[model samples]
Target: MRRLSETEVRAAVRGGVSRDGEISRPLENDATAIKCFGCGQMEYRAREVCRCGYYLRGQLEAERQRNADDYLSRERNRFNQLRKRRNISLVAFILALFLGGLYVTGNLTMIGDTLARYAFLVSVVFVFGSLKIIRELERQMVELSKRLN
Candidate 1:
């Protein structure tokens, strides 16, 4: 199949309907239509704006913003959530490093050795947990990038 011309592709993404041998993307109330990230189709659905898995997630955020006032309140909530996750992973990595150091010290009694082992275990858990969060953030970043395109 022939590749769609740039004009045709742009039209299609803008949610154009074909007519008179030309595709035209329509906007509501004659408003300028924003490009959709998902399916390259322009849609008014705030949730439909993203072409990525996070489109609905963006919608949810929009909803939250619409209902809320006060930048401090909104930013605080966002920062707290981000910080909590970051701290979890940070603590885990630090614990792991500390345990590794203890193991290297090689001066532990039986109980100390057991404690070090447990610390190491906890560290492993945190590392895995941090990785999970990173993966999620990566997914979101990718979706945002599509919008930029």
Candidate 2:
């Protein structure tokens, strides 16, 4: 279920593959060794990464699945947090709107213009919360990449 490089795969096809290939013995090799998605650590050969660790697509895949799971978990957490914040902000925004509406419909004191200001504030708060979640997810991505290195 792993993706492998053409060479390693060719080796496996040619029966030139190592016994490790049969037993699914993950080579100490990195991303260059096999196509296992579960691979980590960049592979290198003769001072170059070309033939390095096999870039285990198998292991990398597994790791990615795990990372994806973790990411989902984190996303759930962030979603909850943002939902709570948004609920509170939305309530405040609604209250602001109500007041603005009352002023507009009623007489002067002309606070109608304040409605735009309140709306701007609410939007900013929501945007900031969303960006925070995005930033967190990106950080997770970077850490996952390191596992394969």
Candidate 3:
């Protein structure tokens, strides 16, 4: 594409069309028939006042902004989800510790034979499951932080 001088851009914007009065066939039916003074190409949209290269540059900038917004939104959502999961895991770990303490302190004997036997096993399951989840979330959080830099 040809390089448009500052004066040409200003003229195209101010004058509303090229000095040659060349009306593009596709844009002739539209209200304003302003072509890009720089490249001499008609506006892509009916309301567009500038030439093709400038319009395309504006479009590219908009696309880049949209992509950046999308990336930030995705990262925020992922971080929120990870935080929620970590909180749940932490709660589970605390409950498991409490239960295990009760079993170790012989408090399970008060609950009787059948229930006492399963308390330790359930506590063990909770501890391991919470640890696994916490480890995985920590790894993901690290990875996510790395991407931000």
Q: Candidate 1: which stretches are off by over 4 Å? A: 1-76, 107-112, 134-149
Model 3 quality (TM-score):
0.63
Worst 10 residues of 2 by lDDT: 41-50
Q: Tens digit of lDDT per residue, candidate 1, span 1-149?
A: 45677887777666554423434444533344444545555444434434444364565567568766565465556555656665676666666666656656764334576786776666667667767875675565455445434
- What CA root-mean-square deviation does each model show from the true structure? 13.9, 13.7, 11.7
Task: For model 3, name the residue pairs that clash.
Answer: 36-51
| Tens digit per residue, CA lDDT, model 3, 36-127 | 55676656445433534455445545766999999988997998899899999999999998998988888888988678769888999999
Note the clash tally of each candidate. Answer: 5, 36, 1
How well does candidate 1 score on lDDT at residue 35?
Answer: 43
Using Cα atoms with residue i matched to residue i, what is each candidate's TM-score against the true structure?
A: 0.34, 0.31, 0.63
State each model's CA lDDT, in order.
0.57, 0.52, 0.73
lDDT of 2 by residue, 1-149 (tens): 45677777776666543544342333454343434223433232223222343434455567679988898777667656655665565565556556545555554244455665565556556556655665565565456446534
Looking at model 3, how many pairs of residues clash?
Answer: 1
Which stretches in model 3 have alpha-carbon errors above 4 Å?
1-54
